[model samples]
Every structure is written in C-alpha cells, then in structure tokens.
Target: MAIYKLDTGWRADYSYYDSFGKRKKKSKRGFKTKRQASEWLTEVIKDINKIKNPYYDWNFVDYFDMNMELKINSGIKSETVNAWQAVRNYIVVKYFSNIKISELTREKYQHFLNEYSIGHTANTVKKRHQILNSVIQQAFHDGIISIDPTYNVRITGTKESKDASEKFLEADELMNLIEHFSQEERLSGNSSLSSFMIVLIAYSGMRAGEALALTKNDINLDHQTISITKTKGRDGINTTPKTKNSVRTIKMPSDFFEIYKLFISHKSEWNKNYELFDGRKIATNPNRTLERYEQKNNFNNIVSIHGLRHSHASYLLSKGINIAYISKRLGHANISITQSIYVHLLNEQAITEEQKTIEMLNGIK
Candidate 1:
C-alpha cells in the first residue's frame, strides 16, 4: 500500500493477492490529506483480510441478489419479497449494478439517492433507501465492506408529502358513507358486495386486503367479532396477514352483525373457503368505487379504499378511543406505528383534552 501526493490531493493505492492467488490492484484518489488516504487504505486492507474469499468480486447487485434469497428463505412475505425485487430491478440496478461492494463510498451512495429522490415522494424515497440499506448493512456484517455507505445519509425527495386530511373522512362524513352503503346493500337485497365491503372496512378498520380475505367462517355472529388472519394480495392471491400482530379478532357492532347475518343469509352456498367479496367483483382499482360514491353523494372529501381504514382510525381517535387499543384493532405491529400515522388526529384530541383540563381547574377556583 502507498499514499502519494497529487497536484491537488492525495491518493492511496494497494496491491494484493486474492484467495485464488491471483494478483489485483485497487486505488482511491482525491483525498484532501495524506492521513485520509492512509486511513482509507488501512480500512480497505482490513476488509480484504476479513473476507474468507477475497477472490470473489461481488458487486452491489450481487449482494442484493444474495440478500433477497436469504430473505425469501427466511420466510419473508411474498409481497415484501416482490417489493424488494422491484427496487433492485428499477432503482438499485439502474444506478449501482456494476459498482463493487468495496468501491461504494458514502458520496457515491448519496449521489444515487439524490437522483432517485428527484421525482419521488419523501416516503417513497425513504422506503427504497431502507431496502437498499438493508442489503448494504448485510454486506458490512459479512466482511464484504468496511463501512455502511448508507450511514448518516440525508434522505430527500422533491415531491410534496401528501396532506393527512385528504387521506381520511371526518366522523360525520364517514357515518354518512356507511349509512349510504348500508342502504344500498339493503335495497339491492345484499347483492352489492362492493357496498358491503365499504361498510365493513369503515366499521372494522380492516385493510381492504384483510376485509377481502375474510370468509364466512371468519365472522362470528354470536360473538359479534370478526377474525383477521389473512389478506388478499394485489395479485388476487390469499396470503397471511402483513404481520403476526395482524392476526387478531376484533369486536364489531351488534347492529353491523345483524346486517352481516342478512347479507350472509342471501349466500347460503358459500363454503368455508369462499371469500367475502367475489373474486370476479374485486376491482383492479378499488379507488374507483370510492370515487363513484363520492360523486353520487356529492361528497367534498374523496378518499381511496385504504382511506376508509384511515377514516375508521380517525373516527375512533376522535371519540377518545385508547390509541393502544386502536393500534391493535387496526392490526398495526405496534402502537408507535399507529401514533406516527395518526399523530395529527392525536394532536387535535390532545388540544381538546387540554381545554377540558383548564376549564375544570378554573371551576375549582
């Protein structure tokens, strides 16, 4: 290894023999100081020695593939595995396909993230970064690299974050929506499965996929509860819930169960495996159904099917429901996840309670 001074900066160069006894050379340049170059070269040498087979030249893409295989073998959900594959194909490969794991620097990784954030939302960019960072972290742990390129990297995106209000309906609006759907189901003699689904999601706070995956056996009329054990993926295939916490039983309104009994009575032929919504009737874009309802009712706030889940949580929060209970009811992995998503609603509730506390204190005087 050698550090040499250049016209503007210093450079570190190294030569070594691989595990196969083949000679190879690597170098990095443009460091401001000789010490910086020496330190980097030392890290590289240490990393090389740590690897059992330094002969294997694995690129970032190669590490990503291995990470994906490990994740699959570890029993990650198919949807999650598919998402990681998409990130690899569309983002990671597009930028870092040829970059060797040892060659990845913080600056280079930051540049790739800056490019990716150009037309994406902050959340979208953050999620993609997390996926890539996981693979890079594994490479570091496996002694393929000395440092995590993702560490302390600032994540930014040009696209504006979505407004929270637009993601859910207020209590009155949600009640009106449910009432409208309920009337539609009754008038149609329980034939409108979409309308029924909208009502179920609004009341139960179940994700659209979880609601769709429900079977006749999952509903308990006597107990006034519904079991959430699985979800329907975007591919129309049934799979386990998103997390272990998602496998839960939640209470439903007795009146809602009455409507359910009426609805189920019309479907006597449905077997235990038969899904709540007919596969043929499940729209590729569920938001279209919400749009139709909004137009018919002249609703000012338009929300997607997933928005009904948000609306459900918002409604419960507005009514002073315990957030921890709400988290479990919504099948969130933890209360923190629920709090982050509905922090705005929680803030509003906090203000109301603060006012009540001040008023009670004043009355004591």
Candidate 2:
C-alpha cells in the first residue's frame, strides 16, 4: 500500500493477488490528505480481501445492509426508507439470512417466491419482489453476483389485488361522527380537541401528517382558514409538505371553526408555536378516541383517522363540485390523482345522470 501526495490531492494505491493468482491493483483519488487516503484505501483493501477469500462467505443479507447505508446517507425520505426496512427485515429474518450470496441459485430464489406467495397478496408480494430485484440487479451490475436471480421472475396478481379502492366517509357517516363526537367530546374535556380535528380533517381533506403537524399559528379562527405548510412524515418527524401542491389554505365552516376556538380558550393553549393540542396527548393516535366513539355509538364502518380526509373528498364529489377545486382542497399534486382515486364515485355520478336521461326520454314518449 502507498499514498502519493499530488498537486490536487492524495492518491491511495493497493495491490493484491487475485483468486486466479493474477496480480490485481486498485487505487482511489481525491483524498484530501495522506492519512485520509491511507485509511480509505485500507478499508477498500480489507473489503476486497473479504470478497475474494475462500473462507469469507458473504451473504445477500449483509450486502443489503451496506446498500441501505448508502440510501440512508443520501437523505432519502424516512418513510420510504422505513418501508424498505420492513422488506429488508422480512428477507433477512424470514429467508436467505444464512444463505451465501454467491450460492443463491435461481431454483432457490423461485422456491422462496413460492413461500412468499403463500401469505401475501399479489400486490404485496410484487412490492417485496420489486425491492429484492433492485438489490439483486445492483449486485449483478457491481460484479458481485454472476447472474440476477429475479431475471425471469414473473409476478401473478391475486383477486385481493383487485379489491375496490379505499373506503371513505359518506355524508351521513360524517354527520353521525360529528354529532356523536360533539356530544361525547363535550363530556370528556380531551375529546373536544380530537372532535375538532375530526371535523377539520373531514371537511378540509388534510392528510394525517398535515393534521399532526398543525401549529397554533397555522389556524386563523377568525378567517376560518387553516394553512397547511408542513406535515409529519412516517418517521414522526415534521417536515415541509411532500409535494408542492400539499401547501394549501383550507377554509373551514363556521361551526367547525367555532369548535377550534372553544378548544383554544385557555391562555396556556393559545401558544403561537405550540401544537393546537399543546398539553394533550390524546390527539397522538386519535384511534383510541375513535374507538371510544365507536364503542359508544356502535358505528357500522370503521373509518380510520385518515379516512376522514377521504370522506371529505367523496362528500364533495357527490355534490358535483369541480374536480379542480377538490384537487386543490385535497392538496393533490395533480387532478389526475384525484380522478384516479375517485373514479368509482365518478362512475356512480354517471349512472345517476343516465337514470335522469332515461326518465326524460320516457316522459317524452
């Protein structure tokens, strides 16, 4: 090993014998100092040694960890990283943890896919498959693997994959939720805060992340508008809205705005930078609050907190409102996304119009 000082920076060089007894040389440039170059080169040499030594059997599980390290270092969205992490855990713990990467045969990978198909839906399996394929393809490109195991893998979808789009709140359901909660929330002082949040979320179509990241100053009770400039990520960290369209101003109804005013009555709760529900942790999950509402009222559908946003959108669509206005209200990046999710509802509207056209024709006849 040697480190050479140059006009621009230092260069590190290391040489070793390949598995075939051929001399192999490797070098890296742009290191700031001799010490830095030496250290980086030393690590590279050690890694190369590990890759070639007959006794050192590297597995895909460990390789994936190193691959993920690069992803984390590159400042990827925490939510996306978290999703890949679940896939990584499933791979490492469920299968292939002990199998050597070089020993991974196409037959063995096919067997693993068969096992994976037993439990997960087709869409679910496909997601995991996509992640694995990416890593395996990378390994192949890096010359670490002889062939890509998933090269010919085909994904077959299931009936579960074709399940109808998400469930949303109907007008009746929203009203029931609000009425039930308005009474129940008044009974429990903590309920009032979550109650307002439910109404705001249902009416405004704000994401759970945007709702959680709501600050006291973001709300204008007098103007009946709430500004959505930031959102909470899956990692529970507050960050700017994921998309530019996510930053929006949503107008609230008078009664709904009044609910917010009533909750912030106390001087301690009126903090500018503090969260709307500053002292209360009940708003953390809101599921418990919803559970309480369900238990007390015995509701038919189990709508999630996020479903309120869906409900709000569906409710607006039923009124024959402009899709563009709804898109902006929902803070969707484009109207196409709104149309895609609400296509079923749009079909229902078409059916209603068809019925009217048939009636008009019948009356003329």
Candidate 3:
C-alpha cells in the first residue's frame, strides 16, 4: 500500500504481482485525510479476503441492513428499531438505494439531503439526518468507508418549535372535563371508563404509555402514589419508561383513588390488567371523546390528552411551586426541562412578584 497527498486531498495506491511477475495495481483518490486513505486501504484489504461476502462491495442499503441486524440483536427498544427501519426504508427506497457506501461522497450526500428535503419539514429532515448519520458512522467504524458522507452536510427542512405547547386545560377546565368523563362512564354502564385513564394521567402526570402499562397492583390507594415501572410503546409493546426518572412513583391526588377503584372493578374476569378503557384492547382514545365534550360545553381551551401533563405542570408553576419538585413529579430527568417548558409562565410570575414588591415598597415610602 502507498499513500500520497494531492492538492485535492489524499490518494492511495496498492499493488500485487502475479506468478508470471506481472504487476496489478489499483489506486483511488479524493480522500479528505491521510488517515482516511489508510482506513480505505484497510477496507480494501478486508474486501480482498472476503471474495464471496454479499456485503463485500455493498451499497449503503446493504450496509444499513447488516448494521441494523446487529442493532436489533443488541437489545434496544423495539420501537427504536422500528424507527430506524423507517428511516432506512425512506432513504434507501427514495434516493440512496444504488449508491455504494464505499463510493458515497460528502458532495453526493449533500445533494441527497437537498433532494430528499424537498417536501419534508425541517424536523423530519433532522430526524432522518440523525438516523443516516448513525448508519454511515457505523460503516466507517467497520472500515468500509474512509469519510462519513453525512459529515458537514447543512440541515434543511422546516424545524419545529422547541417551545412548550400552550394547548392545555386550566384547572377549572380539567375539572369540567372530569365531570364530562364521569357522564360518559355512567351512560355506557360498562366498567371500562375512558375518563379513568385521563384522570389518572392528568393528576398523576404519568405519560399515556406509562398509565397504560399500569396494572391493578401498581396503584396504592392508601399511599396515594402510582408506580411507573414501565411504559407501553406506540405499538402496544411493554417497555421501560422514557428515562430512569420516568420510572419513579408519582403521587396521586386523593380524588384519583376512588376512580382507580371503580375502574379496577371493571376489568374482565380473565384479564390481568384494565387494558380495555374505551371498549378496546388498548387503553384510551381521548380525541373523539374530548372533541364531543368541547363542542357541547363551549370550552375554548381544549387540549390533547397528552396536554394534560403540560397543563398539570403549568398549573403548578402558576401557583409558585418549586421547579425541581415539578420536574421530578413529571419524571423529567432534571429541573432544566421543567424550567424551559414553563419559562413563559415563570416570566408572568416574575411580573406579578415584581408588582407585589413595588406595592410593598410604596407602603414603606
């Protein structure tokens, strides 16, 4: 193997002699660094050893399939594996199916990004970039590529806002929603109550998946705290919570105990858990039910069911509660997440507190 620097970047050359003493040489150029050139040489040597390997001269799609198999067998969440598969399908089928990973270039990848981003949102592009970057990095790690094609590529796509959503119910509005839920539960006469799930999540700040993962024994009426050991994925598979913090117990309001008891009584005789809240195998579907309530009650601030957790945090923040406490209660890994989300509400509190201070100073004057 021989390496040389060129005005373009770096080049690598290799040679082998036949029995007849004839020289057979191969050379490749356009590597960004001498180290990259060396890495490519290593990949070439490995490919020469594995003449019959399917992935020996594979494209990005082939490499992606190989790496993803390892990723799946390595025991990541199935949902995460599914998401990665989705990214692979979108990229391979749409644009990069034929491009060999060894031949993939930064310029070509930039072009791919530009073309792939045409109709997608910035957030969508960002997510795809994350997955693609990982896939390409894996190829580089395996010495299949010298440079990561995804490197230095500018992101394109309409990015979503980082601000916390304001579409959540006020405290009084939540109570009104609970009342509506009660009505629905009574009229159905089936013990399966959609409102129970909502009320459980709203007051306890458990995620939709976390609440769905709860069993009858997970609730402690005497202690007024619900344990959140696991969470269900969107695919209805049981998995660990979002983070270690999310796996902690959440203290429930006293009002939640009776609701829990009532719902637990409704579980099918043969079933282990109350997974039939809306008369289905899954837990709850709040959209249609809440939509009807909002129309009939003339409620203006109708929040999504997930919005209940936001509303809970917003309400507590509005009441001058500690941010760290709120963060832990919501199972956020740290207080900063809570602070970022409720910054707008916190700013309002500052204004109110400042006004109160001025009023007190005026009395002193």
Q: How high is the CA lDDT of each candidate model?
A: 0.82, 0.75, 0.73
Model 2 Cα lDDT, one tens digit per residue, 1-365: 78899999999888877779899899888988888997898678657856775323567788777778887798877666877799888765578888876667788888887777875688887888887777777776765655678878766544364323446755787888776655534624746667667766876788877887788788886788999998766666667887899999988888776556655663244444587654332246576676567557666556777767777888898998888999999999999999998899989988998999999999994
In angstroms, what RMSD does candidate 3 have relative to the true structure?
6.4
| Candidate 3 or 1, higher lDDT | 1
**What C-alpha lDDT, on a 0 to 100 scale, does residue 64 get in candidate 2?**
75
Candidate 2, residue 108: Cα displacement in angstroms equals: 3.3
Poorly placed runs, candidate 3 (over 4 Å): 1-56, 115-120, 159-165, 184-193, 266-270, 273-284, 291-302
Residue-wise C-alpha lDDT for candidate 3, range 74-138, written one tens digit per residue: 98885688788898787776687888777778998898888877877767788888887888887
> Between candidates 1 and 3, which one is better according to TM-score?
1
lDDT of 1 by residue, 34-76 (tens): 9899899987886777565552377778878887888879976
For residue 214, what is the lDDT in candidate 3? Answer: 75
Q: How much does each candidate deviate from the true structure in C-alpha RMSD?
A: 5.5, 11.6, 6.4
For model 1, state the Cα shift of residue 308 in Å: 1.1
Q: TM-score for each prediction?
A: 0.79, 0.74, 0.77
Please count the clashing residue pairs in each candidate, in the order shown: 0, 0, 2
Best candidate (score: lDDT)? 1
